[model samples]
Target: MNIEDLRDKDLQPQLDELIGSLTRMWATMLDCHRQQRAIIKLVSRSYNLKISFQSESQRQAALLLSVELRNLCSNFQNWMVAQVHETSEEEEEFQETCC
Candidate 1:
């Protein structure tokens, strides 16, 4: 459609929602990356301990990372759901009339 034919008023909310979804998605990614680094640090510390291969703290950290990753996936799903298509009522009516 031409620029004059476009209605930014109706699109503004949808655009805002999309921006929110993107922001949430980015936050989730960063959180997961941060958790991954934490897990790596735990592993490295466990190795440095050198007393034995047994480390409850390292194990717990790994488990927590797994849970957090699962939670991140759930958050991503919510973010994706927030990006549903939105059209103005007038636009919908016009398309119906044309058809």
Candidate 2:
């Protein structure tokens, strides 16, 4: 596709819809990340409490799960940053070519 294709009015609505969907998805992800972090904090605080876990294995499992969740959150944040950077670069290129 050429610059004209990128500037086409027919694609504008689809692009707008995609941006809206992405914005909503980002908001949902942020909410979920906040909840996950809260859970991690709660689990970490109660890590030593015998009442929190029935057995050693269960405690270990909880610790592992929390670690994995933290990693997931970190990975997601990195991915988002990368995506933003990539989009910015693409926009710049598009403008340079089209304008």
Candidate 3:
């Protein structure tokens, strides 16, 4: 129900597992993006035409979506690193206080 419950229940391992899963998922997303780009490039080269959004607004939207995805990934990485540091600090503090 609270911080004490989380600590007492020893949920760190589960949290760690979830983080690992998410990390894998993120990597897959990035791989998919790369594959999509490659496919698009291949198609465009094969056809000798630009393959892209049909309208200016659509192109802008796609650009924004890409920027957002990049920001999301950057923020997620930063958060994950901070979480690892926070967990280690908490463990150290708990050890100091309890033993």
Put down candidate 3 lDDT per residue, 5-81, tens digits, no spaces: 88667787777677678667766866776676576557446643455778999989977876786676567657656
TM-score of each: 0.41, 0.53, 0.47
| Clashing residue pairs, backbone N/CA/C < 3 A, model 1 | none
CA shift of 11, model 1, Å: 2.3
Alpha-carbon runs more than 4 Å astray in model 2 = 1-51
Per-residue lDDT of candidate 2, residues 1-99 (tens digit): 787877676687787788678767766866776676687668667756655778999989988987897787679668767766776786688679757
Candidate with the greatest TM-score versus the true structure: 2
- Candidate 2 residue 20 Cα shift, in angstroms, is 12
Off by over 4 Å in 3: 1-51
> What are the lDDT scores of the predictions, listed in order?
0.61, 0.73, 0.69
Q: Please give the RMSD to the true structure for each candidate, in Å.
A: 10.6, 5.5, 9.5
Report the number of the highest-lDDT candidate.
2
For residue 74, model 1's alpha carbon misses the true position, in angstroms, by 27
Compute the lDDT of residue 52 as modeled in candidate 3. 76
Cα error of candidate 1 at position 73, Å: 21
Model 1 Cα shift for residue 57 (angstroms) = 30
Give the C-alpha miss distance for residue 15 in model 2, angstroms: 11
Error of 1 at 93 (Å): 36
